[model samples]
Target: MLKTIMLALAAWFAMAGGGGLAQAKGLAPLAPVAPVAACADLARIDLSGATGAPTRQEAKSVTEAGAKPYCQVSGTIAPAIRFEVRLPLDGWTQRYLQTGCGGLCGNLRIDAGKAEGCAPVTDGSIVLASTDMGHQGMDTAWGNDPQKRRDFAERGVHVTALAAKALIKAFYGRDPRYSYFSGCSDGGREALIEAQRYPQDFDGIAAGAPALNFTIQNSFHHGWLAKVNTGADGKPVLLAADMAPLHKAALAACDGNDGLVDGQITDPRTCRVDPAVTLCKGAYQPGKCLTAAKVEAARLIYQGARTAQGQPLEVGPLQPGSEMNWIGVFVPMNADGPIMSGMFASDTINHLLFTPNPATPYTPQTFPFTLDMVAQEQPARALYNADNPDLSGFAGRGGKLILWHGWGDPHISPINTIAYFDKVGEAMGAPTRDGFVRMFLFPGMGHCSGGDGPSEFPLLQGLMAWVESGEAPAVMVAHRAKPTHEGAPLPADGPMKPPPGATGMPKLPMMPMMPPQPTLPPRSRPVFAYPAVAHYKGTGSIDEAASFEARP
Candidate 1:
C-alpha cells in the first residue's frame, strides 16, 4: 500500500508540473515539491521593471565540505549601484543575508557576511548579497551626482536587498523565511540605516564599529586631528616612532587596573593616564621620548575633538590602547603633508560635503576645524548620519539588532557606539529595548576585527538563535587568533648548524634569530551585553571564557 501511494504521488507530481493537485475522483490532493532553478537559468531571470537587471550570471561548484553548487549574479541597480548575489542551488536554509561594505564602499565585498567568523552561507544554506554602495573606488567624485550620493548613503543597500529577495523568490519558488544584514564601519552605518529608514527590510541586523555620524566624523574630526598634529612649520609634530613609548606608558599605567596584567585595558574609559608622562625631560630622543608639541598633540587626540569653545564634539577620545593604530593617521608618508585621515578629510570636505565638485581645488589646509565649518556641513550630515535613536517600528515588528564595537577601534571611536546604544535605551526604555536590542563591546579588539584581544565570534548564529528560538545571548565568546610565522625566514649574517637529529650530507644553514613571539593574552572571553561587565572569576585558566562572569 505504501509503495502504491508513493507511485501515485510521483505520477501526480509529473502530471501537475511539480505543483499541488486538487482532489478529484475521491483521490486526496497531493502536495508538490517546488521546482529549483538551474544555475544558468538564473542568468535569464528577468529583473527589468524590477529593482535591477542581472548583467552577469554564472554557476560554480564549491569544494568546501557540506557545500553545494551555487549561482552568482552580478549587476547594477537604478542609478548605477553595483551589486552581487549568491544563491545556493540546493539545501536552501530559507534565509537571506545582505552584507555591508567598508571604507567609503566603492567596491563590492560579499565576504562581509562572514566577518568575524560569522558564516551564513557556509554550506550554501543561505543566500548572500553585497553592493558597492553606489560608487566605485575611493574617489568621492560621484558625490557631485545627488542621486549617486543618495544611493551611497542608504538607497543602494535597500534596493540591493529588494532585488536580492526578488531573485531569491524567482530562483527558489519561495520567499525566504528570514532576512539579515551584517556589516562593520560604513557597513555598520548601512545596517543602522536599514533599521531606521527601512525596518521591514531585515529581520535581524548585526552592526559593528558603525560610522553613524558620518559627516561630522569624516570631516571636522578628521580635520581636528590633522590640525592638532601639524607643527608651526606645517609639518607633522608626531612621528610614527613616538607611538611606542606612548603605548607602553599607557599600558603600564592601566593594564593592571582590571585585576589582570593582560595586554588589554578592559575598559579604557576608566583609564586616566597623563600623556605628558612620555615627554622628554632633556634632549629630544627619537623613539624614547616625545617632544612637547608631540606630547600636546597626543593629549589632544586622547582628550577628544573639541570646539573652539572647548565643548566636546560628537566623536570621543581615542582609547588608551589605540595609540599604535594612531600612527596611520598622525604620521605623514613624507615631511610635506597630510596622513590618511587628513587625505580622507580633504577629499570628503572638498568633493562630497562642501563642494561636491572635483574641479574645485581643496587641500587639507583648505578645511578648517571650526563651528562655522561644522554648521556648513549640516545638510550633508542629515543625508548621511544614521544616529536616529528610535527603533520602535523595528522592535514592534519583532526585529532583533545586535550592535558590537571594538573598544580598541582607532578609526571611529567605540564610545560613539556606546553613546548611541545609551540613547536608544533611553528613548525606548530599558525593558522594552532589551527585548530586541543588545550591544557587545569587545575589549582590545580593533576596528571591525583583529587586535591584541579576542575578536572572532559567530555573530550570525547568535542573531539566528535569538530571532528563531528566542534564545538571546547572555554572553558571546570571542576568540583571539593564534600568532603565525608563515613568511620567509629572517635575514642572517651566515649559515648556521642544522637540527641535532638531521643526517644530511651538507649542514643546512639557519636563518637569523627571530625575535621571540609576544606572549598572547587570553584566548577567549565572554562578551556581555551593554551595561554589564565581564569580570574575572579568579579561578581556572584565564585564557578560557569559563573564568569570566557577567555582572552589572
Candidate 2:
C-alpha cells in the first residue's frame, strides 16, 4: 500500500515537475536513488571496456538557451550520453527526440537524434536527443556486431528511447506528459520499431519514406546497384542521363490526373506511361534524343527491382512524386554520365550491399544480392522491405502512427510501404487499423525528406499536435514545385521538366505539379488502425479490409 501511494506520487511529480519548477507538496521528490542493493551498478551506465572521465563539469549545471531555458547534461562517463533538455514556457509542452543512428551510430552530434545538424529542438515544446546506438567508426557499423549487440541486448533502438527519457527526467526534474517521434530512412524504421515493440514509447509518430524492412530493402539496393548498367557493351552506369526523357513521359501520362498538370502528379497510381515508346525516334534537342538502348534502360526502372525467377522483388513507394530530378549532368541520369557515376546499381552492389565486412573481413560465400535474388537472402531483404506488419504494442498504448510515401519516388519504391500498411489492416482488421494508422501518398517527392517538391511541411508540428492535443493530421500538403525546387546547385545542364500541368495552363504563384484536389478547407479523416476496419457503405466482401470499405 505504501509503495502504490509512492508510485502515484511519483507520477504526479513527473508531470508537474517537467520544468523542475513544481511546488506541489504531495508529489515525491525527483532524484535518482542509487540502489542500496549491490546486484547492479548504479554509479554510471557501464558499457564493455568503458573507462573514461565523467561529465564535463564536476557538478551539474542547468543552463538556458535563449528564451527556452534548458537542462544541458552529459552522462556520468566522460562522453556518456550527452543531451539538452528544452522546456516550453507555455502550458507545458511534451519532450521528444528524432533518432538517426543506424548500423553503427557513434558520433553524437547535438542534432535531433536523427537530423545531422543540432536540431535546436526549436519548437513551442521541449525536445530531447542522444547518440548511443553504439557505432564508433564512420558510418553505422556497431549495430551488426554480435558482441556489441549482446552488450546492448540486441535492441539498440529501444535504448535510444530509454536513454533519452532518462535524461529528460534527470535534467528537468520531471517527466514529459506526451512523447512523440519523427524521422526518415533509418530514422523511419526506428520510429516504426518503437511502435511495434514499445508502444508506450511515443504517443504519435511520423515515419516518412521509411527505410523499413531492413533485410530486403538494403539487399535490393545491392541487386540494383550491381545489376543495372548503361554502357554500350553492358557496363554499369547511372540512369540520370536517360532519366530525363523517362521523367518527361511519366509526367505526360500522369500529370493532369489530379486536375492540374503544371509538372507534378499527385496520384502516381494513374501514371502508366512507358518510356520505351518515347525513345530516339523523335528530335529531342541537339543529339539528346533517347537511343533504343536508353529506351530499354528506362523500362527496367519502371519495372522496379526483380529477382532471378522473373518474380517481382517486393519494394516500397519512393517519397511521393520524387522522379522529376534529372538535374546535374552525369550518365543515363546525369549529363556527364561518368562510367562510375552511371552505375548506380553497381555502386549500391559494391558499397552498401557487397561492401566487404572489415571487422571479420572474411568474404561471404555470396557477395551480391542481384534484384532477382534479393528476396532469397535475409540480409538483403533488410534494406527496404517493410515486412514487419505487427503493431499491437503501439495500438495497445494508443500510439498513433502516420506514414507517407511518394508514389513516384525514384530512389526508394513506395509500393513496399503500401504493402506493409495493407497487411497491418488485414492483421488487425480495418476497425482498429483505421483508427491508429494512416498513410499519405505524396504525389512527387523523393526518399524521405526532399525531391522536386515541397517536402518540408509542418510534419513535426502536425505530429506533436496530434499526440499532445488529440488533433490528428488529416491533410498534409506536399508541393514538388516549391520556389526552391530549382536546386540551383545543379548545373544548368542538369535536366528538368516543368511540373505537371505546366502545359500552357493558367499560371499560379505555386507551380502546379499535378491536378489539384477540390480546393476544400482542411478536412477531418479517421486514421484507420489495424484489427479494426472503418465500417462503411460499400458493395463488396466485408471480411477483408480491401473488400469491406473504401479508403477516403
**Candidate No. with top lDDT:** 1
Candidate 1, overall lDDT?
0.72
Cα RMSD (angstroms) for every candidate in the order listed: 13.6, 13.1
Question: Candidate 2, TM-score vs. the true structure?
Answer: 0.65
Best by TM-score: 1
Write candidate 2's Cα lDDT for 329-439 as tens digits: 123323333432223233223334332433333111233335434534445434333356788878887788888765544444677677778888889886677667767
What would the TM-scores of all predictions be?
A: 0.83, 0.65
Deviation of model 1 at 201, angstroms: 0.7
Candidate 1 C-alpha lDDT tens digits along 27-68? 112222232766667667666546644333344434445555
How far in Å is the alpha carbon of 15 misplaced in model 1? 50
